[model samples]
Target: MNRISMVAVLIAGVMPFTVGCATKKYTREQAAPIINKTNELDDLTAKNSRDIKDTDRRAQSGIADAQAKATTADQHAVQAGQQADAANKNATQVNGQVASLAGTVENLDNYKPVAESSVHFGFDKADLTKKAKDALDQLGGQFSSTKHFIIEVEGSTDSTGDADYNYQLSKRRADAVIQYLADKYQIPAHKIYLIGLGKDKPVEKNATSEGRAKNRRVDVRLMTNTGDQQQNASANTPQGGK
Candidate 1:
């Protein structure tokens, strides 16, 4: 119960409190790293999740773009196929017409020139003038009394332009003439053998305007079998010694 005993008791009591604080500090120190590590792991997991979401979004966008492009390409391919099919169908039709015409050209007899003509056109013209129509009408009238005649048509062009262009132009001009004759006189399409000679057979020089004009012409001739010609000639002969 003296000063030393009292001091000893006080020290004993303070020792227990200090020991408890030390133990608590040690436990906190030990758990502090674990808590800090757990927080760090959570932050890392969240960042990884965000990264994964961003990657997924980008992947989806890329896939969508690719799908759109693929669809567009497929559409283009379909259109190309349709165009090719149309072209093939047109080619088949043209081939059939040509074949039919070929069969009509095999007659062995009665192929002589009955009438001839030169249909002229102005610069870059595929249309017939009034004078050209009149000439065609006269030819048609003359042929009204003839029998089994086939018209041979040769389309020509001047040498003033590109050869291929001139060839097509000459063909158009010939087509114009043929169409006119067919529509006006009811001539059959098979009675015509037409060609576009272009600048290959020029009637005159293309250097001059007048010469070019002369070159822009279609030479047409009518031909008939020998039997028909003779019959017509005999019919036309005057009756003698009757």
Candidate 2:
């Protein structure tokens, strides 16, 4: 009776241990699948984060490029404004000179031509030659002893080009002569009366090349109010004869 009872107890204990080992193996298999799925989700989250950072960097780069372009455009606009202002200032100076000359012409009748000279130029040229400068030097030499005098600078061009173009060319020629006189002799601007007549006041016939060349010239005349002053002095003096 004691041997049969001991064998029964041994069989019951072995059966309970086998059931516990099977339950532990099933729990490990389920937990392994859940952990693999969680790892896959973490990898996906990391990839998404990298993509977001790259996109943000690209957006910032684009914004910076746009700002750089805007700054360049603003710089170009400022440069253009400065160039325009400079051109306007040059035009204003030319206009003022023309106005001053016009005012001097009003009292032209009081003056008489005392000395005169002609300066010739090449075809479509406004530059003064050596001969032209020498002629001007001779003309200006009289100014040292002269008093109450004014200079008349009359510019004319050949009838070769358009009327408008000829007018501008004549003006350029006159300016060249005036510049030389003012620079070398230090002649004041107020003492000079300037005009551009173009082909309208040509000194020679435009039929020949020589004549046309002669026509492209500037006539500078030194005039004085000395005669008017003398007449005024005589009129103001006491006279014995009526």
Candidate 3:
């Protein structure tokens, strides 16, 4: 050994030791930063997962609440609809009853006479016969018992005369009956309404003498009172005058 060879050998051995120490230091520093970053990321991920689970729970609760409210609302609507239908049905029934009452009132107000007796007239004359006068006198007695009385003296004639002449003659016959009742029984003239149907409503055939005599007659109709008719109708009803 020379001096230069000894120096080179020692330097080479020392350089290897220094290189190994530097490599170990660098590996430790890099591994520490990586581990810290990984831990931070894991914490953030756990927090986000918990938040998502809480949001899902809140959403489920909201859905349940909404469903309950909807069910209650549906039930209320059904009840309201049923009540309204019942009210409408009741109104319809009331309207029908009112209409029926109105119709009955109208019918009573417009009541006309129904024929109860008849009087025969002469062949061509409108004069009152003795038999006719007797019949009229009997009818006049019934007027005092009635609430309202109207003597509808409707005269009819035989088919032998002309239509115009017969109508006039029938009118004269009704007038004569009214006058006779007024003069004999002191009945008011306004109580009687004279009408002449002529041969329009002949009760018998016009070809025979007996039929002609039958046709030439006056109908004395006695009308029932509105109260009486109403009472009759009420008697026939199910509610019995309610």
Candidate 4:
């Protein structure tokens, strides 16, 4: 009775423990595939997030490249517009010069020379020398009795600088002469015809210093359409001072 009773008690206790272990093992096996599936899903989500970030970076880079290209195109357009404007301005200047030449040719015979003078200047200088001023004074004296007269002032320059710079220099020389005449004789603006020839019409070759000095000069010719005015001006024509 004692052995049988002990054996039955031990069997009952062992049966419950074995059943509990089997249930625990079956639960673990069933949850294992779900855990692996969850792990796989987590890995896919992380890869998708990385791919989305990389795509966004590439899209931002592409947009930046497009913006850079657009900025470069805008700069090129601005440069092209500036160049076109410069070309148009040059064309307009040329047309005005042609019209001026035509007018001069048409009115050539309407005037006759009454008095003439020439004044020289220093290198790159527009200020009048004492001798040059004295020479101009002689020409200015003739304007008192002259009527309906025009003073032709042709300024020149030596070939020593840029063509555009020389043109401006010659114009400054001409302005100096005009100022003296206008101030001293009260000459009207309409009675003066001015031209800046620059180095295009040098009186002497520019190869020598003396020749260049001679080229830096302004030529003045007092002219009138009226015969009586011309005769009157001839009496006061400048002599050796010119």
Candidate 5:
């Protein structure tokens, strides 16, 4: 209603507005660096989070690959061990077979014969006559119980034939005798020793037919040591060494 009171009211209202403006200005100025730093920190935090996720993913993949490689290595080692065991077993079997063969060879080396003789054959014939068979049978009977023995069959041919033909014929005769002994007596194959002398060592003259017939013959030699002969004589008594 008065002039002084109106003035005072106007100053009070204006003063409040001015103070509010100053306070807002001060707050804006003070908060400017803080806002900028907060924005930068947010960006760095986001980048660090992505980097951690990527590292975790890579680590998991590496672990998976390592486990797979280890499994494969274990399987391969098992297979190699099996192969080694098979090789060792095969080696043992082969060694056993070799030992058996060596034993057979030793038995052949220790063999001794009981009785032997010579028998004549016709020219160019590889067969044995009835008389020749009979003689061989008698010789074989001398060693009835013996399981191992050596029979050396030496074949000779007459001079009536060519040298080469006589040699071949002598070989055939020797082979025939060996085969007969093997088939009839069930003798082991390693026990017999056959040789063809052809006309090299003729027991009779080759000029006459009778002498030539005698030359074309097979001579069987019985192997014997002094001790073996003595034992054979004791067993055979009057029959002697046949």
Candidate 6:
């Protein structure tokens, strides 16, 4: 055989193996970018999941803070409402007291003494006898028919006890008479003035039994603004309570 033919045979034998190596290198080059891209995408997905978890935690914390503020506001509202109610009640009471004071002031100069009566009592007692009730019944009837009339009741006691004790006993006697007149005649309590003289203003001497009985008496004086006898009795006695 010639030398050229022998060289050609040697080249043919190695060509298939060289082509196979080149094909494998080309395929590996093409797949390298796809593998790197897949790794980058996996890392980005893990970071996104961590960020989403952090955002959820912050949102829950904000919700809890808002709920605490809402609870505080509700408690403050209840306290304010209760305080407002208390203030309103105080204002109403003050207004009523002012009105009553005004009414008393307006009627100061329009009344005068017109008539009087008396009821006697036993020693150291507040209960009324039959004679006392009969006297009060007579006065009550006359006063009921009159217009704008007020009664002043003065009570006294015999000088047999301490002054303080006598004073309180005298007051009890006056109150007993006042209550009877009010209940029996339906007279308003505002029109009556009550006073306790104790042993101070005695109409009789204190040494004798008859004089002490006269001292232990309740004197009731009726006064009126209506004036038929105003010119006849102009020096009307002043009514006072102590």
lDDT of each: 0.86, 0.92, 0.82, 0.91, 0.81, 0.87
Tens-digit lDDT track of model 4 for 77-134: 9999999999999889878866755664577687789999999999999999999999
Candidate 1 per-residue lDDT over residues 1-242, each given as its tens digit: 99999999999989989999999999999999999999999999999999999999999999999999999999999999999999999889878877756755776254778777788998888898888777777777867876767788889988877889999999998898899889988887767888999989998888899999999998878777856658889999999995
Scanning candidate 5 in windows of ten residues, the lowest lDDT window is 142-151
Name model 3 segments beyond 4 Å from true.
Answer: 1-109, 112-115, 229-242
Please give the lDDT score for candidate 3: 0.82
The TM-score that candidate 5 achieves is: 0.48
**What is the lDDT ranking, best to worst?**
2, 4, 6, 1, 3, 5
**Of models 3 and 6, which has the larger TM-score?**
6
Q: Decide which is better by lDDT, 1 or 4.
A: 4
Error of 3 at 151 (Å): 1.5
My TM-score estimates for the predictions, one after another, are 0.55, 0.57, 0.48, 0.51, 0.48, 0.53
The residue pairs in collision within model 6 are none
Q: Return whichever of 3 and 6 wins on lDDT.
A: 6
TM-score of 3: 0.48
* lDDT (10s digit) by residue, model 5, range 1-242: 89999999999989989999999999999999899999999999999999999999999999999999999999999999999999999889878867755764565554455567888898788899999988888777754555344578999998876889888999999988888878898755545677889899998888898898899899886653445556878988876484
Lowest lDDT block of 10, candidate 6: 228-237
How much is 175 displaced in model 2, in angstroms? 0.4
Q: How does candidate 6 score on lDDT? A: 0.87
- As for candidate 2, its clashing pairs are none
For every model shown, the clashing-pair count is 2, 0, 0, 0, 0, 0
Is candidate 4 or 5 superior in TM-score?
Answer: 4
Best by TM-score: 2
